[model samples]
Target: MLWVKAFHIVFVASWFAGLFYLPRIFVNLSMVPPESVAERARLLLMARKLFRFTSVLAAPALALGLWLWLGYGIGRAPGNGWMHAKLAIVVLVLGYHHACGVLLRRFESGVRQRNHLWYRWFNEVPVVLLVAAVVLVVVKPF
Candidate 1:
């Protein structure tokens, strides 16, 4: 159980690192001036590879989380409201991840629907979600 918990933490941290960074890349991507073909291409490649690697990391993190919750019964009790809140945040995080993919696709298609400032704000979403999740788990304030 401890080993599982440890690995889960590691994977989650790694996944969050990707979540934190990919958006910064998007910010840079959005800021890239037209005619900088090589820079755009390079940024796109980095975003693509990071997204793929981050996705790979997310799978094990989520799987181990489920294992901890279901198999280990970490949050099955009646008073585990913190767990419920954390789960909701997880869903939001997943949605944010999908949104990132969509944004990447749009960028790939040469759509510049949003400015860099918007992406800068967008990049902060996961940070807040991660903080909430960590607090929920560690403090269990519910």
Candidate 2:
């Protein structure tokens, strides 16, 4: 179980790395001038690669997380309200991840309607989710 926990932590960290960096890429991409063809291409390549890698990490992280939950019945057990809240946050995180993918596609399609400022704010979404998730899991306030 400790090993599982450790691996889960590793994969989650990797996933968060992607969630963090990809948006920053978007921020840069958002600002790339239309004349800067080379810069746009480079940024697009980076975004595509990071998105794919992060997605791979997400799968194992999610699977291990679920294993921890269902294997020990942590979420199903009583007084596990914290676990429920954490799961809810995780779902939102997944939704955010999906949104990032969609945004990447839109960017690839040359849709830069949203400015760098928008992506700068958008990038904070996962950070908040991470902080909230850590607090819920550690404090178990509920």
* Per-model lDDT: 0.97, 0.94
Stretches of candidate 2 off by over 4 Å are none
Model 1 lDDT tens row, 1-142: 9999999999999999999999999999999999999999999999999999999999999999999999999988999999999999999999999999999999999999999999999999999999999999999998
Candidate 2 residue-wise lDDT at 68? 87
> Per-residue error at 120 for model 2, in Å?
0.3
Alpha-carbon lDDT of model 2: 0.94
User: What TM-score, over all chains together, does every model reach?
Assistant: 0.99, 0.97
Number of clashes found in candidate 1: 0
TM-score of 2: 0.97
Q: What is the lDDT of candidate 1?
A: 0.97
Show the colliding residue pairs in model 1. none
What ranges in model 1 sit over 4 Å off? none
**Candidate 1 TM-score over all chains jointly:** 0.99
Using lDDT, give the best candidate's number: 1
Q: How many residue pairs clash in each candidate?
A: 0, 0
